[model samples]
Target: MSSDDPKGIAPPLVELPISTADRGFYDGFSRQVTIPAKIIVTLIILWAIFFPVSANETLSAANSTIISSFAGWYVYLVAALIAICAILAIFPQTGSLRIGYAGEKPEFSRLSWFAMLFGAGIGIGLLTYSTGEPLSHFSENPDIIRGAVQAQSWDAVRPAFVYTFLHWGFAAWGTYALVGLAIGYVAYRRDLPLTIRSALVPLFGKTMSGFGGHVVDVVAVVATILGVAVTMGLGVEQFVVGLSRVGLGDWLLNPDGSSSLPAIALALAILVGASTLSALSGVGKGIKWLSNLNLGLSFLLLLLFAIMGAGLFALKLLGQGIADYIGHFIPLSLTLFSDEGPVGEQLVAWQLDWSVFYWAWWIAFSPFVGMFIARISRGRTIREYIFGVVLVPSLVCFIWMTLLGGTAIALELNGSAGGTIVNATMADQLYATLAVILDPGTAFAVSGMIVVLLMTYLVTSTDSAILIVNTINGAGDTEGEHRKHILFWGAALAAVVGSMLVLGGIEAIRITMIIGALPFSFVVALMAISIVKAICYDLIRKHQGVPTTAVGVAADKK
Candidate 1:
């Protein structure tokens, strides 16, 4: 072992070289990583297109098997990830470690950084689920199913927010933070590529440079595509609903009230086309501009709720929700329900649909979102990155859920909505609640604004994913010159969402995402272990008067 090896415990900080060479068609792509990932994604898209029924059934069966077998594993893994984030942030040694070279400043301003973070991280979810999730939970949650509180009653409110906050809170963002922290640490300090395999260096070391690394990158690419496809599928459903509400056309919806396949295809085309263009403009310009715009619109929408809706009730729910969320965080995070009896089956099913599904989605999404977080989060300490990436966005989600979802619940309680908000389709709840709160003209106007906001969020998310996938495929090169690659991935993403929507609507997308997330979840667990090991070893190196930070290491080499 070298002198820096320290009893052969610390893995050598060797940079794994990833090649991006010109194959005739796949020019500027990593042959091993990009080719395999493309083959897998293309096969899935073709399957969903040609054999829709078979693909749907297979996805459904696979989702069932995974959920039933790995529900507890998912729960504990995510909870442990959150715990790892907490430990990293609370400890002085790890928390104070900069994400980039010493003296490096943040690339984006705090406002822009936060806006992009929200937009790329969970903006679609806030719009898609802020009203729907809490309202659904208000009607029935694990607590309600267990008879701890009556459904849709005053007693249901706290429990509803508990589960809502649980899904959207630290646990969700911690998944992303841990991945980002790992990648940023490796990429900046150790001079490794900013890809998923880099985060596993401390664990697998030189093995990451071979087929093992390519497998990790391929999994990340596939997971990112499916994860973003889920968001796109759901967003398109709500986008169609918003269009119909704004007097666009009834053709946007089928008779049974789902988004029509034609409408979904058109929306996907528009979104992916726009996203491809924005991605060509690169992260610094197009994404930042759109993120800022959507964040402003989000604030406007939230302000409308604060003005016209039940502000005091939402405020009260916010306080109690935080308390209940804290009190029940442990149980909610780690609890696993058995599918043994009627009540047990109901609880387990609920967990699968809500908690487990959210965990899978976030884990799958971490590659894209986590890499985006790391790209924008250079120069910040681990504590700051955790706070900004996990805590702040989560608190914003809580406030959003309280104000929007709380309004829907309050309207139901007061009978002003007459069950319309609760009875409407999930995609239609936000507009339904707004109509109940505002006059028809005002509701129509606000609905138009929401559609615009939704469009921006979708564009931001799609573009960000396109860029991140390209980054991984190009071995972490973020150059904006790869327009062809961007366009190809954009079309691929559109095809994925469109074909899946045709196959089984959002359900197909959800099942595929859950399945895709499973493999990557194991990767994330390894990442958590790798980061802890790296940090501890670096601290030991520091105590032994060796260089640890990027600057120190660079200077020592000189």
Candidate 2:
């Protein structure tokens, strides 16, 4: 029923007719959503497996076109999402609005909440890129390309972090925060299903309950799978490399040093198996414990670098990098270089490779991460959720990049590593850095620790993703007793990653992820608009003295 308001005033919330029924294998699943999503994902995986070269070439071409055509869109859309989040947090009326019903408290402790947030959102990324990204940018960024700084020199350090922080900072998390806030606001406050389609109620109304809704959820599911697959694919590569570094044998490596098929298969079997079991255990027990453990291990690793690596240099770089990142945030977030000439071409290509790629990756990844954040973030105020989701993890990532990547750069500067760290593959840079900074015995021991940590991160990320995917498919029935669905998704995810790696290595995964992210980016843009509209309408209801809180309004109706 509509609230007692003027004819022109909108209802405080619209409850959609979302339905899920028991299917034989997919108990509590929304067949409309899950069936199509599975079909599309299966088709892609089969294409890659059956026609490897064709799939790789098609994906590459599609990736190039999307980057060239939509680079500016990705840049501006992500930047705007961050601005939207900031506005919601700063505006007193919206900021103070709680995510859940009145008087409700958070379901998770602050530490647990933060741990899950960091672990699920960017855990694998930090391990994968902390050393590689910074070192790559330190050697050459847009500033270096533009002749504003000398590569690998003192002049390059600040700019290196400027770009590194750009990729991992607020913009990345803002995408997640906006989506999470939108879903949480409606799902928790208005008692709607916690699916991607629910966030679009304000924009589409009842249309979101029908074919339109299924389409939205399907797109989200596909995006989530591809997004998580890319991360898993990257993690598997690092996992295998970590295995080789710790004496797992050259059988894990090919003649050219890439991961062998056996390595990929073994990594997937372990990761997916662990993740599936964790997903079956639900978010509270398995996911929470693993997140906390990984957080602890992460701190231990960071402490190792702080004690034995370039502590002073990393500290200095941390401060300067943060400052430069803040100073140049806006220009970097919005600027899209054009293809004018050789230099322009280089800048555009770099932006496409780095900034645009990161934006797409974050967007693709946002559905899973955002939904997970929303799932765990009940009872938080809009302000708290935005800040907690966007700011905290980002700062943590900055510190990680500075400490781990800064150590590598410092070693190179001081001639201790003599380019060994930089020369190592992106997946092996962390090991190389550890080797240079620690004694042989100590390095081997720490490398073993890192391998374990990487496994935890990979498992945590994969399990969290599998849970989110099933949540969407189940029409937001997060606690559904559907171990079969979880198991199926885990296998499917492994297949996707394994086939893509076999097809075109990590490059194929990257290309496909970028393409998958494109459609969801549009969905996210709509979510931003819908949440703003819903919040604005809620403010109007508050002013008019209509009960705006879900619990209060429900009591009145009773």
Candidate 3:
């Protein structure tokens, strides 16, 4: 270890070498991550441009049949690993370890920190799914009768909220927490690059700096693009739908009354343009302000939904949903099925559509979300980080889903426009629900709020993901993002979304997302093991009175 090493500290097993490559393609781009990632992205764009229909069809088939068939394994494995993350944080031996060095104060305030992380993590998803998921579950939940009136029973309502909670709950955020803790510790404590490969330095030592590391970073960059693109596509589609509902323009509506391609492209242009500006302003001002704005708008939307819709019933569902999520947390998380019996058949189908798809999406997005949170979480202990990352946002999600989703469910049960919202397309469910529950004027006003909320969230997510991808490209230099780099990614993301919109819309996006996520699934498992190894290395050295040289300690052990 160096003479400057702190007490109770040890050096990393290998020093990460600094790159001196030429920045040729783009004026300030790092050849390591930027060149390869951009090349692959360019190739994808070319394919999508020249062969859009064939590309969409291939991905759709892969996702629907091949990927969905094995999705059970992915869901169960991710759930188990995330559960392990939660367990480690609660374990006394490891929980107290600071992400930074001991006694270092956190850089950002608690409120700003929470606002930033929460906004980036699930902004677009909750906006899209908060109402649609619950309403969809109310109809499709096999636990109760499929009829409109019969679906409002306790059996149906309980599972609708429970399953929603499960998807957005502990397991999902736990994935982020796990990745954040690993990367944050390495980047802040060990003083390594903030890329995903740095998280494995404790396990692989100097080898992480070579070909293996380049592959890891490349995978992360590609995954981040596809993941964020999927979300951007969803947000844009919903934004267009909201605009149509708000009577923005008749031309925004398709011939079949759906959102048109031109409308989606317009939304993407605005989203990407604003997000590029936000990225230019850096994280402190524009990103922070937008995140706070998102939090405020989210709370306002939730409050309105509660007040306008069923107040008492939503409250009741909130309590019961928490209880059911806790009660079935273990079994529901672990359950999988084959095509044998009728119930089993239903479960397999449900898993494929909802639970499995959600796990894959979360996993796909974990690198961007995780790294963003890690950048903000500089000085928090493992326990504190876990609580904030896993628990707080989860509580926020539960309330949001229960209030919005429960309101939709309650409206259905009360026989006031419930069936209409359920029958509407998933993208329009939120607007449809609000229209039925609130007065026409109020519903129109609330639709406007939804659009603004989605815009802020869309901007926050896009900007943060872009910054993270740039950080990975710059070898984890968060403050050194180039304007061209930001613009490049912003435009690239918009192009991807627009192409998918032209071809098959949301289905095409899903197919691309699952393809990107498949490799990262293996990455997630390795990251969990790397975190465990890092913690073990720390604990063992502390207990054994080993020397401060990280490599020396390992040598002594050997």
Candidate 4:
């Protein structure tokens, strides 16, 4: 083992608290994720841009069939519970197992940790869906869906929060957290590469050295690129639409949502331009600053909405939302209703569209997220990592939605924020609804703020994903070695998002997500198995006199 190699990667090492290496596990786990991530990511971006739009329809339809076909719906229910239980089996108050490299500590601070972890994972989704979802659910609330109550019952309000929790709760976060934990354990604790194939090390052991490992790595990267590309595409569209509502430009005004293709293309070009500029500036200076800005905007907006929207009611709903979340959490988390009633049907469709879709998205993006998590979690403990990675930001996001979304629901009900929100679908109308409710002379000012917030978030997401995917592509190691590679993927993401907007819009991104998600589910499943195996191996090392910490493990590698 040496300090530097052909890929600019330091030589592999072992890290645990113990002294001896189980040669089989060590060798397999020590193998590298050697591939050009941005190259494949760029190809997928080009494909989305140039590929026929007809596939969007086919993919969407297939997504419908595939998600519904999951063992009468209950299968997904069962799967969620299984995932949650498995992860907690190794729960630490802080960090999880990791494979340390260089001088990197795999863990980050509690607050900084959540900002990056949650922001990288779902910040885009939070902005896009928060208000829009609650308002929509109020139209025909969950009590109606559950058959336990009617559409207009107060129960309606409870179900709005209940179903919201259902969509974003353990099932979704659990999936991402597990993948992250696995990658962290294998990479920092065992000194593995930051690639998906490395996830297989705990199971395949020494067999990962040959073509099999490369094949695994390739699939993981491809699935991740497309998955993330679609997200970027969808996010850009929603952002553009939101900006348009606030008077950003004529580029956003496509009444048919069709005539706006050229505008969307222009929008894509701008994002590409900005992403390139950010990419050139490097991660610490440009990307991190913008990410912090985005986070600040989100927090500010939440504060304003809480002060102005429904005030007391908003605060109350957040508390109640948590209660609702806790009470209905397990049942909702694992629910798989086969009743086939209108509510049941609607719930099923929403789950497919929202929950299952989110699962697929996270799975597709797991390698990128997992790689990033592992990189930051070098010296942290299992429990602390889980808290930041799962609980901290999620609770923040949940409260944000509650305060904002709950207020929207209240306005619609009380004739304050108005019923216009109940009708808005695209994200911009979300703010539009808020504006009308607040009805401040500062209405125009608020709109301007939201538009700016959208742009800031877009920058953060694109750069982080770019830097992360580049690391994966650059053979699972990131640093000065992958700057050009990161820029390539950044530009590609803009291209894909732009093309999709021209071809469709949000519809286009949804299509890509469905198709990309299918294969990635298998990847997620594989990761699940690999993690279980790693935990087992960890126990053996802990009990059998093996070094389990990074310093000890690295010492043995010499």
Over 1-558, each residue of candidate 1 has an lDDT whose tens digit, in order, gives 333654644333757877668556657778899888989999999999898778977987887786679888889999999999999999988898888776778888899999999889888888989789988999989879988889999999888888899999998899999999999888888788888889998888878888899999999999999999999888889988999999989999998889987788778877888888898899989999999999999999999999999999999999999998898889878889997776998998899898889999999999999999988998898989998888888899999999999999999999999999999999999999999999999999999999999899999999999999999988878773678778889999999999988888888898899989999999999999999998898877766666666556666677
Q: Tens digits of per-residue lDDT for model 2 on 1-558?
A: 246535546455546777777557666888999999989999998899888878877887887786689999999999999999999999999999999887789999999999999878888888989999999998889889989989899888888888899999998899999999999899998888989999998788888889989999999999999999888988888889989988989999988768999999999999899989888888889999999999999999999999988888889988998888888889888898988966998999899889988899999999999999999999999999998888888889988999999999999988999999988889999999999988888888888988889888888899999999989998888878878778888999999999999988888888888889889999999999999998998888777666666675676578
The reply for model 4, stretches above 4 Å from the true place, is: 1-53, 70-108, 146-148, 256-259, 339-347, 439-441, 549-558
In candidate 4, clashing pairs total 46
lDDT of 1: 0.89
Error of 4 at 359 (Å): 1.8
Error of 4 at 6 (Å): 36
RMSD from true fold, candidate 3: 3.6
| lDDT of model number 2 | 0.89
Q: Judge candidate 3 at residue 503 and give its lDDT.
A: 77
lDDT, residue 9, model 1: 41
TM-scores of the candidates are 0.97, 0.98, 0.93, 0.84
Candidate 3 residue pairs in backbone clash: none
CA lDDT, every prediction? 0.89, 0.89, 0.82, 0.62
Off by over 4 Å in 3: 1-11, 18-29, 142-154, 343-346, 547-558
